[model samples]
Target chain A: MKKLINQPEQIIDEMLDGIVSASPSSVRRLEDTTVLVRKDAPVDGKVALISGGGSGHEPAHAGYIGKGMLDGAVSGEVFTSPTPDQVLEAIKATDSGSGVLLVIKNYSGDVMNFDMAAELAEAEGIETAQVIVRDDIAVDDPENRRGVAGTIYVHKIAGAKAETGASLEEVQATAQKVIDNARTMGVALSPCIMPTSGEPGFELADDEIELGIGIHGEAGIEKRKQMTADEIAAELVERLLPEVDLADQDEVAVMVNGMGATPEMELHVFNRKVQDLLQEKGVKVYDTIVGNFMTSLEMAGCSLTLLKLDDELKELLDAPSHAAAFKK
Target chain B: MQLTVEDTIQWLKQFNDRLSEQKDYLSQLDRAIGDGDHGINMARGFQQVAEGLDGDFDEVSDVLKKTATTVMSKVGGASGPLYGTAFLKMSMECKGKDVDAAVLADMVEAALGGIKQRGKSEEGEKTMIDVWAPVLGTLQEEDFDAERLKQTAEEAMQKTEDMTATKGRASYFKEKSQGHLDPGAVSSYYLFAELADVIGKGA
Candidate 1:
C-alpha cells in the first residue's frame, strides 16, 4: 500500500517507459504494446531469443534484452502472463530470417499464451521453436513444476547460442539442455503485496518461513518455523542436488538470487553456505553469481540455481555479453 | 425463444456490470488460495469487451469474436486466455446465426470444450470447468431453459467451495485450497447467470 507510484493501472506502462529511457542504447519499448525489443532488432540472419512473464519480476525479461541475451521481452500485468497478441508482436519485431526461439517458463498462463503466440507466428509463415523451463526442484510433480531462477541460465546460454548465428533448432536445443540440467529452489521469509490488491498474498508469523515458494507468491510445499541461514541453505541444496545428479569433479555454476527485498549481505551469507555445501559434496564450482537477477516485487526471500556444467555450457556461460542486468 | 445479437450484447453488458460490482469479492476468493488478481483481471477484460462492442455487428458470432479478441488483447492473465478461448469457440458455433435454446446449449458446450482444451484441465479440478461441465449437462436435459441453466450454474459454483483444487496456482495450496470458492468458477457463473437473465427478459 505504501509504495512510490502514481496509479496502480499505469504501473506497467510507466515501468516500461522508464526501462526504455534508462537503457536507450540497448532497448526500446514497442509502440502501444508491452514489448521491449533490442534497439537494432531483427538482427540480420541470427535466431532471435525471446522470453517473458508478468511484470513484477523486473530486470528479468526486460533487463536481459541486450547484446547477447534476449532480443525481445514481453511483459504482462503484475504477476499476470502476457496475452498472445503482445507476445506475437514481440515475435514479429524480433524475428529475422533465422527463426525465433521462445524460452518460456512453465507457468500455466505463460505456457498457454506463448504456445498460442507460436501458433500465430507459424500462421504468418515464421519458423518458431520453443523450450519450456520447469527447473524448480521445490515442486515434486514434474507435470506441474514452476520455473524459477534457473530461467536466467536458459536466457544466457540460449542467447549466447543465438548470438553465434546458430539456427533456431540449435538455440532451442541448447536452451532445453540448460533446462534439463539446472535446478532451482526458493524460500520466502514473508509474502509480497500485490500493488492493485493492497494486501499481502499471505501472512507468515515472525518465526516462520515458507519453503519451495514460487516466484508469483503461490504457497510453497511446506511452512515451518524459521531455520538458520545454514539450515535453509542445506535444505534447499539437498533438494536440488539429487535432481541434477552431480558427480565427483563435475563443474557447476551457482546463482544465489535475491527475491527483491533480500539484501546482498544475507544473499552472500546464504551463498557462503551453498559454496561450502557444494564443496563438501566434491562438486567443482566453476563460477558463482549472487544478486537479484530475478525477483518477486519486494518479497523477502532468495532462490538458488545450480546449472551442471559441461564444456559447451561453460563456454556459453562465459561468453561476453552486455545486458542491463547481466554482464560477463 | 431465439437469442438475437442484441441479446448477446446485453448479456455482455450485464456480465460486465456484475463483474465490476463483484470485483472485490472475486479477488477475495483468489486471495485465499491463489494470487489475488482474478477479479481485477476479469473486470479489465470486460471493460475492453465493452469498448470493442461499440461497432455494429451482424450476428451473435461477430459480437463474440470481437469480445474474444478484445479480452485476449486487454486481459493479461490466465483468465484472459481461458475466457477468450471459450468465447472464440462459442463464436465458431454461432457463426452467421441467431441462437435458440438448442444453439445456446451447443455454444455453451463448445465454450466448455475450449476451456478444457486451452487449460489442459479436466472436470472435478475445482476450476471454472467444475461449473461449466455441470451446466453443460443441465443444458442437454429435456426441459433445459434459461432458468434451468442459471440454477445449475449457481449450484455448481457453490459446490466448488467443497472441492480441492488440482490445477493452476490453487493446486499449489493442496488441502488449504478447500473451503474457499474457486474465483474462476464464480466469475463463470456470473457469465452464464447474466446470459440467462438477459435471454429471459427478451433482450
Candidate 2:
C-alpha cells in the first residue's frame, strides 16, 4: 500500500508519460492511448513486431520497444490484458508495407485480445501474423501454459530477425522456434499488492514460498516452507530441464529474471547455482543474463528461463540492438 | 411479453448500479483465488457503458452493439473480452428483431456460446461459464420464467464456491481455489439477474 504514486487510476498514464519523457529519442507515446511506438515506426520495408500485457511488468512490452526489439507495445492496467481496440491501434500504428507480427503471451486474456486485434487488422487490409509464447513449464498442458520471462528471448531473437529485413513469415517462424525451444519456471517469496485495491493479492508466511507463480500475483502451484537459494535454484532448474529436453553437451542461454523486488545480488547468487547445476549436467552455457529483465510489480521472486540454442539463435542473441532494457 | 429497447437500456443501468454496489465484494472474492481485479474491471466497463448510452437505438441489437464495443474498449481484463464477446454475439442474434421469451433464450445461448468460443473454456472450469451455462439451460425450458431463470443463475453462481478452478489465473492455485466464489461467475449472475428483473417488470 505504501508505494510511490499519485493516484491509483492514473498509474498507466503517468508511467507511460515518464517513459516517453525519459526515452524520447527511442520511443514515443501514441496519442490518447496506452501504446508506445518506436520513434521511426512504420519502417519502409521491415516487418513490425508488437507485444504487450498488464502494466506492472515494467521494462517488458514497452522497454523493449526500440531498434531490434518491439516496434510497439500496448499496455493494459495492472495485471490486466489490453483491450482489443488498443492492440489494434498499435498494430495499425506500427504496420509498414511489409506486414506486422504480434508476439503475444499465453494468458487467456492476452491470447484472446491479441488474436482479436490480428483479426481486426486483417479486416482492414493489413497483413498480420501472431505467435503465442507459452514457455512456462509449470503448466503441463500446452494450451494452458503461461508465458513468463522466456518471452524476452522471443523479443530479442525475433526482433533481430525482423531488423534484418526478414519477411513477416520468417520473423514469426523464428519467434515460434524460440517458443518451442525455451522453457521458464519461477518461485515467489512474497505476493504482490494491486495499486487500486491497496491489498496484497495473497499472503505468504514468513517461512514459506510459492513455486511456479505467474506475474499476476496469483498463488503458485505449490506452497511450502522456504528453502535456501541453492535449493530453490536446483528445484527450478530440474523442473525446467526435463520439459526442455536438454541432452548432454547441448548449449543453452540462461536468463535469471527478478520479479521486481528481488535484488541483483540475490539474482546473481541464484544464477550461479543455475549455471553450476547446468554444468553438472554436462550442458554448455552459451551466455548468461542475470538481471531484472521482466518483473511482477515489486513481488519478491525470480524466474529462470533457458533457451536451447542453435547457431541461428546464438547469432540473433548476439545481434546489436538499442532498447532500454537490452542492448546487443 | 417482449423486451423493448428501453428495457434493454434499463437492464444495463440496473447492472451498472449492481456492479457499483458490489464492486468491493466481488474484488474480495477474487483476491482469494485470482488477480483481484474482476469487480474493478466490470465496474469500469459498465460505467463506460452507461456513459456511452446516449444514442438513439432502433432495436435491442443497437443497444447491445454499443455496450459490446464500449466494454471491450474500456475494460482491460479477461472479463472485458469475455463479456464483450457475449454482448457482441447477443447483438448479432437480436439484430433488427423483437425479443420475446424465445428470442431472449436464443440471445442467452448465443452469449454463452460466445464466451465458450472466446475463452476456450467449459462449464465446470470455475469461470463465468458456471453461471452462464445453467442459465442457458433454464432459458430453454418450456416453463421458462424470469424468476426461475434468476434463481437458477444464483444457484449456479453459489455452486462455484465448491469447485476448483481449471482455467484462468485461479487454476494456478489448484486445490486452494476451492471454498471461494468465482468472481467472474458472481458478476455474471448480477448481469443475468438484472436482465431478468428488467424483463419481468416490463412484462
Candidate 3:
C-alpha cells in the first residue's frame, strides 16, 4: 500500500502511457490495442518477431522491442493473458510482406489465445509461426512445463535473425534451437501483492522459502527452511542442470534474475555461488547477466537461467539490444 | 422440463447471495490452507455477473458465456481462467437451447472436464477436486433431480471438512489441511446448491 500510484485500477493503463511517453522514437503503440511495435514496422519485407504475455513481467515483451529483439509486443492486463484480438491486432500492425514469428511462453492460456490469434491471422492471409519457450526445468512435466524466464533468450536470438533479414522459417528455427538448449528455475521467499488489493496473495513465514515458483505468485514446487545464498543457488542449479547437457560443455550466458524484492547485492552473492558451481562442474560460462530481468510484482527471491550455448547462440546473445529494462 | 433463462439468472443471483452468506466461513477455510480469498473473489465475480444481468439471455448458453467473460475480467488468479473456461465449455455444450436436467448434467460434465484440463490438478490433489470429485461422482450415479443434486452436492462439500488438500497453497500444509474444508469446494458447492434451488423453485 506504500507504493506510488494514483489508483490500482488505472495502474497498467497509466504505466503503459508512461512507457509510450518515454519510449524511443523507434516504437509506437498499435491503435486500439496494448501492443507496441517498431516505429517503422514490417521493415518493408523483413520477417517480424513478436512476443507478449501478461503485463507485470515488464520490460519483457514491450521493452525487448528494438533493433536486435522483437518487432512488436502485445501486452495484456497485469498477470492476465492478452486477448486473441489484441494479439491479432499486433500481428496485423506489424505484418509487412515477410511472415511473422510469435514467441510465446508455455503457459496454457497464453498458448491457446496465441494459437487462436495465429489461426485468425492466417485466415487474414498472414503467415504466422510460433515457438513456445518452456525453459523452466523446475516444472516436472517436460511436455507441460510452464514457460519461465528463458523467453528472454528467444526474443534475443529471434530478433537478431529477423533484424538480419532472415526468412520467417529461419527465425523460427533459431528460436526453437534456443528453447531446446536453455533452462530456468526460480525460488520465492514471499508472494506478491496484487496492486488492486494491496494484500499479499500468499504468505510465507520468515524462516521458509518456496522453490520453483511461478511469476504470478502461484505456489512453487517445494518449500524448505530458509538457507544461505550459496545453498539456494546450489538447489536451483541442481534442478536446472539436468535439462541441458552441461557435462561436456563450458560456455554459458548466465542470468541470475532477482524476483523484484531481492536487491542487486544479494543477486551478485547468489551469482558468485552460481559461478562457483558452474566452474566446479567444468561448465565454462563465457558471459553472465545478473539482474532483475523478469519479476513477480514485488516478491522476494530470485531465479537462475542458464543458456548452454554454442558459438552461434553466444554471438546472438551478445548482440547489442536496447529496451527500458535492458541496454547493452 | 427445460430450464429457462430467467431460471438461470435467478440461479446466479442466488449463487451470489449464498456466497455472501457463507463468505466468512469460506474465508476461514481458505485461511487454514489456501489464500483466504476464495469466497471474496467468487462473490466479487458473481456480483459482477448479477450486475451484468440485463433481463435474461435468450439461451442458457448466452447466460453462461456472459458470466464466463465477467468472471474472466473480474476474478484474478487461476479461478478466473479455470472457472471462466469451465463456463465457456459448458456454454458451448448447451448452446442455443434451454437447459433441462440432462443439459445441466452435460454442462457440469463439460465444466468439470474443462477445469481438469485447464488447472491440471488431480483428484487427490486437494483443490476444488476434493469437493468436485465427490459431487460429480454422486451426480453421475444418480439421476438428475434438482432436489437430489442439491442434497448430494451439499453432502460432498461438507465432506471436505474432514479431507486434506493436496493441491494449491493448501498442499504445502501436508497434513495440516486435514480437518478443514477447502474454500474452493465450499464456494463451488454453494454455486451448485443455489442453481438446484433456483431450478426447483421455478419448476
**lDDT (C-alpha) at residue A272 in model 1:** 95
> What CAPRI class is candidate 1?
medium
Task: State the number of backbone clashes in model 1.
Answer: 0
lDDT of 1 at B93: 98
Error of 1 at A207 (Å): 1.1
lDDT by residue (tens digit), candidate 1, B1-203: 67888888989999999999999999889888888889999999898787678789989999999999888877767788899998999999989767877887899899999899999999999999999999889877876578887998999999999999988889878788999999999999999899889877883
Q: Model 1 Cα displacement at A288 (Å)?
A: 0.7
lDDT (10s digit) by residue, model 1, range A1-328: 5888989999999999999999888899999999999999999999999899998887887999888889999999999999999999999999987989998888878888998899899999998999999988777788777888999999999999888888888888899999999999999999888999888888899999999898987667788899999999999889888888977778999999999999899999999999999889888899999999889898999999999999999999999788889988
How well is each residue in A1-328 modelled by candidate 3, as lDDT tens digits?
Answer: 4877897767767776777888758788876667888888867868988898877776676888887888888876666667667788889888897999999887655776677679779999999999999887765657666777888888887787777788999999999999998899999988887665566756688899888887766667677899999999898888777777765755778899888888899999999999999889888888888887878778889989988888778788877876556666
Q: Output the worst ten-in-a-row residue range by lDDT, candidate 1 chain A.
A: A137-146
Which whole-number lDDT from 0 to 100 does residue B8 have in model 1? 84
Residue pairs that clash (backbone atoms under 3 angstroms), model 3: A250-A284, B125-B166, B125-B167, B126-B166
Query: What CA RMSD would you report for each candidate?
Result: 1.2, 1.2, 4.1
For residue A33, model 2's alpha carbon misses the true position, in angstroms, by 0.8
User: Clashes in each model (backbone N, CA, C under 3 Å)?
Assistant: 0, 0, 4
Error of 3 at A45 (Å): 2.8
Which runs of model 3 end up more than 4 angstroms from their true locations?
Answer: A30-33, A97-99, A116-127, A189-191, A224-226, A247-250, B16-48, B68-82, B92-96, B109-143, B155-187
Off by over 4 Å in 2: none
